[model samples]
Target: MTQLPSAAPTIATEPGQTEPAFRLVAVAIEARILSGDIQPGDTLPSETNLAETLGVNRSTVREAIRALEQNGFVRRETGRKKLFAAVPQSRDISRRLKTAMVLDHVTFEELWEAMFALEPAAARSAAQRRTDDDLAALDANLAQMRLALHDSDVLTDLDIAFHHLVALATGNRAIQAARLPISELFYPPFLAVISRLNAAERLLFAHEKIVEAIRDQDSRQAQDWMEKHIQDFQRGYELANLDMGTPAALPRAGHDKQ
Candidate 1:
């Protein structure tokens, strides 16, 4: 057999040899979005146009778009149609943070302590600042929780929504944003405990009490009640035979990298 020429060895570049062109483009586009040059619901320039405008390869532009999409800077319309600008949703950011916490094996005590620090404050503020719409939202979530007591999926969603509404009722966007991830992780265990203990009635009563305190604008009562309610969940977790020391479970696939 004839001898073949040896293939060239691939050279491994060091860090910062050259920044990825797509990353640079992503940063530039993200700046535009943050500066309000591209508002939510506005369509991004077409891929071809973006490539030309950014003086990069079309593939690079596509990569940049993918990064933005993953980070919640933009999203596709229904049916995977045209991409549009989007405000970075608190929920999306929270999901990513929760995934990280789970993957890193965050302790239940740490999680609970964080919740204790925030939830009571949120309750107090919500009591003082809640609007009529906030009240309506809380009522709707409570009703949904009542209707879905036996349905784990529905109950879990309502529990999360209820907490989010409370955060919004505080009328502090920063607090709402900060609470989003912690709240998402916080409710699943509640649902799990409720499911095992058949404690829907108790859960509903607690929720009603919280709502009433908020409606009455009783900040101290709201704070105290919410703290007790949350601590009650920790107690239930133990009663349900769950390992409180074990870290929360990660979503099946893996952590979502933004």
Candidate 2:
């Protein structure tokens, strides 16, 4: 029964302005959430209550709530009528961006350039900040990687997981957020390189070097190893005769991890 701020929104309209009243209502609610006047998990007022408070029609309130729900600012349990205030998570936001990237058909060269800037920085940060738990997880990943060297499909999935773990080890949410969307797009090209060049051993070697540097807290060595590893990928792609300028693709069904 937490009440919204008592003041009605002051929505200004210019002559013949086309902005919908529902959007203004949605923005008002989002502003309150962002400003911490309301918190995630707080129960939102009923639509009627909201409409009364905002001096809007009930239908406008419903539309505004729909917008908030779509943006991840509100939610209700399955089979429940009560909406709760919420914040958008990075994963949810990143998933949308990932979908857009796929639909836009971004190039492998574009993906490569982004990873070039991000992965080495992630490795370096992981080396500095990684905990014993991070090392153990990485050790487990490497073990699986060694066993999967000849299995290109499994190895590619492991390769994706390995980089994800490195990003997690960085203890930087921003890095993790930015990396998640781009990570899945790597699967197709990675699989091609490993399968075509039989480059699993080289991949394993680079991973080992990077992990060793991370375990020893040698940030520079970790970054150098990662840079070389990523560079080797481009070489493998060229050797495999794949076009880097070609639009990247989602991993084919049965190729992605469950």
Candidate 3:
């Protein structure tokens, strides 16, 4: 009977564990961060300490830390040797999203739809919550815009900035974060419309109306003007002969940021 206990059936080979050790280390740290075991601004253990605690080589720990830094999970202060934990900034995430949207060939209509929802909400909230400083910034933007109307490059940038200011005026992080990436995505085809149409005067008039509403704390008027402004943008696009059916694109290479 003992001799009849033949060798167990050979098992099929499992998939190979081919991932590098540093990735596992980085993931472990990310888990710690998400679990709140390692809070932002907390100093990370030294390389030697991590190597020993993690049972990995010092080189592996270093590589893991480097990966975390690149992903905005960790950072070192200038002239300081210690590494600090960090959460990624909204702007960094928005930049990455902008790149991804361009790569994925997202369409203009998708961006416009997103903005149509967010922009009016931002205007409505800004009217209710904006501070004196917020009004000052919007006023400054409007003044610059008045001078830049004929300059497409400056005007487009101001237009984008103007909307950003409106979102900022809302004093709502949720609104700001939701709108940031879409705003950046919203500008390329927008510039195409800007270049092809005599839209600046109309654009400035709408901005002035929206600003006046915000100044007067009239949420309804603010939302109404902003919605009309966005609608005017669509109309300008139609008049420009640009095809809305086309996928979104990166700004033409020489164009400045808008």
Candidate 4:
């Protein structure tokens, strides 16, 4: 076990530093985790130990731990007080960005523009990089999608998962990360269109074409199919009489239910 430095610099509450003691403590712990001093799944020191070591109150240590947990740097097991160090997952960070985009009144046009640039490129990369396992996952998603053609809610979820699988197949973390936040915002709106139009079969068809191109390692074909699939989204928006320029919002519960 790599022990924390015994003579760790105590968090200083310098008069003019102005930052809260808990924030300073949180930053210090975060830096240690990022620097690999504390690895994921390693048990973090107790609040008492952390407070004593950092020369802060246990209450401050508690507050810092709460912040760390919320940000995905630390986790506590169910019914347990022991905290574990953890690296933030992409989805964890993406949720915050997703919220900000919604609050900023991000439009469908903006999300569509971003997806237009990312998804096709992701498809191209996936075609070149995908493994047998990636093909299996995509196949499973397609199978489910086919069965759900007339069910908008299920179709909406499958559509998002299908695209996510394609991004994962790319094995490009940058592309995956870039698309993660935009996807929830970009795809859910399609639920409204899916509910309103006879578009589910069209969506399933495009997904099939995209997957077939990916399986054949036809990068250009995959990219082209994905591009058309995305364009169909905008067309669906227009056909449903929804304004693409309107600020995107999360789908209401049961919004996809006919």
How do the predictions measure up, each by TM-score? 0.77, 0.90, 0.84, 0.90
**Segments of candidate 2 deviating more than 4 angstroms:** 6-17, 252-258
Better of 1 and 2 by lDDT: 2
Winner by lDDT between candidate 3 and candidate 1: 3
lDDT of candidate 4 over 1-258, digit per residue (tens)? 346534346475667777898888888788889888889999987888888777888998899999998888999999677889999888777777777787799999999999999999999999999999999999999999889888888888898899999999999999999999899888987666755788888888999999999999999999999999999898888888888899977555334221
Best by TM-score: 2
Name the candidate that leads on lDDT. Answer: 4
lDDT of each: 0.77, 0.85, 0.81, 0.87
Please give the clash total of every predicted structure, in order.
0, 0, 0, 0
Weakest ten-residue segment in model 3 by summed lDDT = 1-10
Error of 1 at 10 (Å): 28
Model 2 quality (TM-score): 0.90
How big is the positional error of residue 147 in model 1, measured in Å on the Cα after superposition? 6.6
Better of 2 and 4 by lDDT: 4
Candidate 3: where is the Cα deviation over 4 Å? 1-20, 252-258
The true-versus-predicted C-alpha distance at residue 23 of model 1, in Å, is 1.8
What RMSD, rounded to one decimal, does every model reach?
A: 9.3, 3.1, 9.2, 3.5
If ranked by lDDT, best first, what sequence of candidates would result?
Answer: 4, 2, 3, 1
lDDT of 1 by residue, 1-258 (tens): 111111101112225647677777777777778777778888877777776655667898799889999888878878775878887877777788888887788877677778888998999999999999999999988888888878877776777778778988999887877777766666776576666787777777888999999999999989998998889888888887777687776545554544
| Best-to-worst TM-score order | 2, 4, 3, 1
lDDT of 4: 0.87
Q: Write the per-residue lDDT of candidate 2 for residues 41-85, one digit (tens) a residue.
A: 999999999888777789988998999998999998796789999
Q: How would you encode candidate 3's per-residue C-alpha lDDT over 61-108 as one tens digit per residue? A: 799889998888988989667888888777887777777787788888
